[model samples]
Target: MKTVLLLVTLGGLLVLSLVGGLFVWWGMGGVDISLHGMIALTLGCLLSLLLGGGLMFLVFYSSRKGHDDEHHRGPEI
Candidate 1:
């Protein structure tokens, strides 16, 4: 059941992104944007996703390793 739900959610997002991309391309018809600017934007977006995913992976990894478990630290001196 969980797997099915995840697949459905992912499929919806895939469809939404495809539609959004088409809309953006259609809206920006014939706009002369610099090649360098487009390359920079694409690289920046890719780097941001990499960093965000790495951070999330570290968080989940730590949690699985019990790093998130609470420990009682007795009265502060």
Candidate 2:
């Protein structure tokens, strides 16, 4: 029951956010982008995703390989 309630609440919040975003977008005139602008947006989004994923991958890799543990130790003389 708790899990179901939590999911429903979260889903409602997501829908509300989307509706609010669309309303703001509509108020902003909703202008169409040129092909070049669209391509730039797509590439920018892809590169951002790639960079974020690569950094997260490094985080996990370093953690598993114990590199993260080194930070917890006092500096050696």
Candidate 3:
């Protein structure tokens, strides 16, 4: 179950990175705004990083909780 969950999470992260890169590429083709392409790309990259980190942290926290619960269960004769 843990293996399956990890694989799925990694797959999702790969897709997210690709989509974010595409957005940054798309944003490159427009007329210059007040802040220009740099700002747009910077913010997009930052958002992606934050999102990916948050997802990874959630998975780790859940796994830790599951293990802790199992550990607290006393041995049965």
Of 1 and 3, the candidate ranking higher by lDDT: 1
TM-score of 2: 0.61
* RMSD to native, candidate 2: 3.7
Clashing pairs in 3: none
Distance from true location, Cα of 3 in model 1, Å:
1.7
Best by lDDT: 2
Scored against the true structure, residue 61 in model 1 reaches a CA lDDT of 96
Worst 10-residue lDDT window for candidate 1 reads 67-76
Higher-TM-score candidate of 2 and 3: 2
Task: Give the better candidate number (1 or 2) by lDDT.
Answer: 2
Q: What is the C-alpha RMSD of each candidate to the true structure, in Å?
A: 3.0, 3.7, 7.7
Summing lDDT over every window of 10 consecutive residues in candidate 2, give the lowest-scoring window.
24-33
Deviation from native of the Cα of residue 17 in model 1, angstroms: 2.4
The order by descending TM-score is 1, 2, 3
Tell me the spans in candidate 3 whose CA falls farther than 4 Å from its real position: 1-34, 67-77
**TM-score, cand. 3:** 0.42
Give the TM-score of each candidate: 0.70, 0.61, 0.42
